[model samples]
Target chain A: MLGKVNHIAIAVPDLVQATAAYRDTLGARVSQSQALPEHGVTVVFVELPNTKVELLEPLGADSPIAAFLAKNPDGGMHHICYEVEDILDARDQLKAAGARVLGNGEPKIGAHGKPVLFLHPKDFFGTLIELEQL
Target chain B: MLGKVNHIAIAVPDLVQATAAYRDTLGARVSQSQALPEHGVTVVFVELPNTKVELLEPLGADSPIAAFLAKNPDGGMHHICYEVEDILDARDQLKAAGARVLGNGEPKIGAHGKPVLFLHPKDFFGTLIELEQL
Candidate 1:
């Protein structure tokens, strides 16, 4: 069970190129752009009517996004992030349901400075999912 | 470059069980339910404010959804469907941009009897994206 989708993260090779493609081709505009060194990625936010599209580009060769791009060269949709009320409670419930937590068993700063934690894709499915608590 | 998110499709092992979980745990009501044999799947629609969530479960053992569920047992988000104006035009543009089309290069009956086409996830990272024309 999840709430409103906070954002859909798309992994790209280059933020500038991907942002421009979404902007020029799709008419989606960048509302915000920030680099999260902790995650080893840079993100550009495209504000949609009700949902936002997040463009993520790996900052370094060692970045996880880079590996994902290597595995999937077309650079498509990455993860679906759902907004939650309490990060801890959600994490506990998910863990109880056998979902593996990727973070340090605690909420960490995410893109846009929101508290977030990632659930291992192996535990949920092939899809990588993020739980964000604003 | 996109409009509002039409719906987020999640692949589950059992539609009834998944729908019940989303309803009981997340309070999401099932707005619609249907079986699309062409797609070899059954779908349950959960209405959100601006975007809806589609729960997908394979109809048979040979169904594609079943293969996906086998690859990732936990069952999670599948595809991010974007509402498009013209399915044919969208497919043409996507092909021009080097994206692979999964369908017979034509829109067919989708969940809720809407015309839709699927873009090969291999063409756009690992995410299977669907373009639905309402």
Candidate 2:
């Protein structure tokens, strides 16, 4: 069901600083900041050899990551995204196995414009998992 | 410079349950638990196509993750490991760039028998980072 790790999303209070840290300090190629108003977050991609590290910042008043930033002021790893061949099949299997799909249990177009669904952290040992259709 | 992401390490309170969640529920190939007493962790590797997810459990009273697990009882993402060409060069460059290295600033043999060094989370957007020589 699970394929490659698509990316690890890290929520940060400041996107510029986080981007600079990964680009200048860590010597990694980072992409420009992209604001997703629909998702209520601004993100920058830290491109690694094998995967990506997404640095996210709250965008609007009701940004999903706002509460997370409030709790983790300095920011932290928000979620891990894994790729799947078929998201609906994956969601059904996960649901049958007693895993809770977040939201309406329907896949939403994610940051990469792919269908994605989030699983409850409680069901996965306190780790928020995002399943993206590859 | 950073290479591929070596692996993402998740510290779990219960290794058996965590492994089962990945194996049985998520349908991923998981390796047998390997106890690294020297590092104070017992870990299982979740084999993914592109990279690996390391599930860790505290191996001793003095385990470094003990404090982390105490705060996050349900377990959470511990650290992100990035592969480096040379550990010493990476450490020196990171130090020069004002990033603080954990411990005595020397590379220690990590779980995979590679020289690894941990960076201070405070210096990296509150996310623990591990640099492993590839």
Best by TM-score: 2
Over B25-125, each residue of candidate 2 has an lDDT whose tens digit, in order, gives: 99999999999999999999999999999999999879999999999999999999999999999999999999999999999998889999999999888
lDDT of 2 at A27: 97
Model 1 chain A worst lDDT run, 10 consecutive residues = A20-29
Q: Taking the tens digit of each residue's C-alpha lDDT, what string does model 1 give over B1-134? A: 25578998888876777777566545456755688777788888877656787888888656778877887677867788887777778777877777788957888877657888888776554668778886
Q: Per-candidate TM-score, first chain only?
A: 0.89, 0.99
Clashing pairs in 2: none
Model 1 pairs in collision:
A26-B1, A27-B1, A28-B1, A76-B124, A76-B125
True contacts kept of 2: 0.88
User: Candidate 1: misplaced stretches above 4 Å?
Assistant: A31-33, A61-67, A92-100, B24-33, B61-67, B70-76, B92-100
Q: Categorize the docking of model 2.
A: high
Q: Please, what are the lDDT tens digits per residue for candidate 2 over residues A1-134? A: 99999999999999999999999889999999999999999999999989999999999999999999999999999999999999999999999999999999999999899999999999888899999997
Per-candidate clashes come to 5, 0
**Model 1: CAPRI class:** acceptable
Kindly list the per-residue Cα lDDT of model 1 for residues A1-134, writing each as its tens digit: 46788888888876786776666545566856787887788888888778988888888557768877887676866787888888889888877766688957888887668888887776544567788897
Which one wins on DockQ? 2
